[model samples]
Target: MSCRIRIRLTSSVVICLALIYIVLFNGLALYSLTKSTYTPASVPVNRGRLYFAYLGFNTWKCKIPHFAKQPLPLTALASFPGSGNTWVRHILQQATGINTGSVYKDYILKVVGFPGEGVDNSSVLVIKTHDWGINERKRYQRAILILRNPKEALLAEFNRKNGGHIGHAKTEHFKQSWKPYVNESARQWFEMAEDWLNFTGDLHILIYERLKADPVNEIKSLLNFLQIRISQKELMCVLENMKGRFKRPSKNLTNYDPYSHEMRSTLLQYEQQINRTIDKRYRYTTRSHT
Candidate 1:
């Protein structure tokens, strides 16, 4: 064969190999994105790879008709479980008339939530999560850290698990007395709080007590932080509608009280530490409606 013919053949082979490599690499990256959970630590270094994988995933996701049509900055409402996440989400949805998303259902479960509803043209998405596995400040546009008094929060959780009462006789799942459960719950709460409190990203700290005391104003502050707008009338309307919706019989059903002197002291210590860390690391203050 002539030299020109040989050169053409070599060029074609090179092009084919390049195409194959691109296909294989992108395929592997997409697979990884699907299977693994995303954390700041685990984020791929290759910007190009992550970009394409996200694009492909979104394209596939858009097939669902109910997905948000506009892409918005993802805003996260993050907290440990039983820390009033659901109530806050309800308020947010009611105030804005926009559906908030959940990463647990969307990312972890790969069900119809958040980004799974697929990419839309929406300007904002609010997601709920109990995960502190990733550095959220770096990932999300904004994050709201909702906290409650650990003792109350843990008691609420215990009661919820025990079928709306705390003093149920020890069962298989909760064989230990209430004290152990509360202690374990508090430990988990502190661990999650520590992980998230260290985040240097845009964050707003909300106290559940403050919200309970004055939901309208507290929700207004939250909406402002999120850059969401709602009129005074609308805000009041939402609050009025949501009133008494979250009241639980557990509050009256449980004669057992765990907020003893020791528990109070322990929680106070953790709160002080958390407060100091917040003061040092974050610009946002704990909401005080007093």
Candidate 2:
């Protein structure tokens, strides 16, 4: 072969190697960043075993009324805002083995304004949400909601919003803006809880603290509420593998833009205030759970 041709071939090889190295290096860097940023701001606990219910939902595709190899666009999982809705959704995603991404990412979880980069799109669309009303999911065909103790919900919110006891994301602004809504917000929680408690709607409500306490039965109750029946073996399997957020102490959390230590005395005051103010409706568990 000519010397010139040989030189050209060597140059091409070197260029290809360089490009490959760049791609690999960048990929690793991206992975590290994502891993670091992905720390959780733990979610509130609910009644029953979360794993069982989530698996059952994922198994929804093959259920009697529903039959499709792929999950429906209309199917969703939402929670009321300010609650640890994000963590709840993440655990469900983990247990169900649903690939995250696609349609739900854009509409359901637009929290941080960052790229809602999903890990996978093939999994069931478990939307993490906190907005509750008769028609919150009106845009979607069907949904399931997870409910948390309003006080505890506030506690999580306080931590998540600023990594402090009471996050002043825009504290002064929040106070001024929140004043009118404060009473309104409490009323809304009461109404939403009571209304949905008796709701004969198409939605299913999963109470948070109860789920945390007795996950198995609560999950069964939820399944029954959804009219979703699963076999005992499958139920057992899901329960065995499940670990919801409240299962761990949230006192140490990275709930916000920066992490926080709820173990502080000052922060405890905010938690107490929120606990005191939340509607009493969600304070008690339903007759069955008790």
Candidate 3:
């Protein structure tokens, strides 16, 4: 071949190689963008893939329609503080194969009931709360309300240290805290109990003591109301998982300061009365629902 002709042929080969590299790189990048954790914006509304004929590399441009709505399951787990919802949640986490090892931050963790945190959200969610929330938004279902006799709840409260504000000890010390006197504490609890028992609602009430005493059946009843199906094997696994404590990090401790010993002791003084109040408020039945 003439020198000029040979040079031209070499240049053409280089250009073709460059173009092939560019196309391959772009295709891989597009595939990766689709699978990333952060959702991609420009990848069409539904489905679009550039399919290439392997033998010739001829590509077909295509798009697929996306379904109109995404379905996510939402359920509410509401309980009086120290009513053993921690154990309930543990059972759920184990059965779902959700958290493989480390804890998974649930996308829909919200506090409902007293001070509702998830009052606004588009995602399907599960909420944990003590106070009952009125179903004004039309999003919430009738609740799974767990009740512990206020007296036992009071004892369990100190043991689990699950009190929202009280758990703070307002201090890192778990001691040197401020709280209503024990008598007042008990009175406050009982009063809160009274409030809960009398408050009528479409609620499936599960007694906590009964759950601890007989978990499998109590849980089945609880799950039935929620419409969650569980096989006997899954039920056994869930019960096994509920035995441990789920101690989560508390941001509340960061901001709250400990109170003087006097303050904590004073709160202890009225604990009994508070507890009694809670005991009285601890019940509701289908009859009341009627």
Candidate 4:
């Protein structure tokens, strides 16, 4: 009887110890899941784990803010589609701790993270707009124009319209709609640049390639342009969480050229005209400042 009782006590102790270990392990895991920080370089490349880690990690790192308490000057974030406008908005939101607004109601964007979609009021930091025509330009007293290379912007827009953000256009899209779309898109691209360059309001031009090359300094310039003050800690947080959810993944380069000879010629003509207009505007601005 003594031996049997001793065995039972030993079993009970073992079971209790097992429960304690299990509890401690799970507690640690939950802590890591909720509180862990991630930088672009720090995230591991394991696809399955990376997806979940990003969902949990980046979303919690930056606190999305409510609408501004006081009325603000309605500023415009004007860009042609696929010119990294959404990415810029994400960066601004991360840094300023205020929601950015858009004129168009993008339900997908609203569901993902942007709470200020379709709101064009004074509560938003800047109202996003693709329209650079005079009528649309008149709505804002200040604007930031984001310009991207025509080739890249057009292709990116095509992919976005045909597929969801971060997805590629299907083969059918390239074969059927690519040529005509390129012609129409190129015209709009040139017009967008020309119209925004002539914007009478306080306007700042941001080149997409330059922003990619030096994100920190570029973003600093952007903040200065918007006259938004941010602490160093907040700026660092923006750097850490720079890439918001909408950025498309890099595509594999192939030897095939998507643009035909005729398409290339047409695009080049518009691109040159846009460049000339921008140069003239830059020179005029420089002379005016002097």
Winner by lDDT: 4
Tens digit per residue, CA lDDT, model 1, 82-116: 68875676566566656566654323113212233
Preferred candidate (TM-score higher): 2 or 3: 2
Q: After superposition, how far is residue 196 of candidate 2 from its true place, in Å?
A: 5.4
244-266 in candidate 4: lDDT tens per residue? Answer: 88788878637556798887777
Native RMSD of candidate 3 (Å) = 15.8
- lDDT digits (tens) for residues 130-220 of candidate 2: 4455665454555566666554554455444433222233444344443344434445555554444433335655657677778788767
Worst ten in a row by lDDT for model 3: 58-67
Rank list by lDDT: 4, 1, 3, 2
Model 1 / residue 229 / CA error / Å: 1.1
Q: After superposition, how far is residue 186 of candidate 3 from its true place, in Å?
A: 3.1
Ranking by TM-score: 4, 1, 2, 3
Query: What are the lDDT scores of the predictions, listed in order?
Result: 0.60, 0.44, 0.44, 0.76
- Global fold similarity of model 2 (TM-score): 0.46
Instruction: List TM-score per model, in order.
Output: 0.63, 0.46, 0.44, 0.77
Q: Which stretches of candidate 3 lie over 4 Å from their true place?
A: 1-75, 96-125, 132-139, 159-181, 194-201, 247-290
Return whichever of 1 and 3 wins on TM-score. 1
lDDT, candidate 3, at 107:
15
Superposed model 2: Cα runs more than 4 Å off: 1-68, 71-73, 82-84, 99-125, 133-135, 164-188, 191-200, 224-234, 244-248, 252-290
> By summed lDDT, which 10 consecutive residues of candidate 1 come out lowest?
56-65
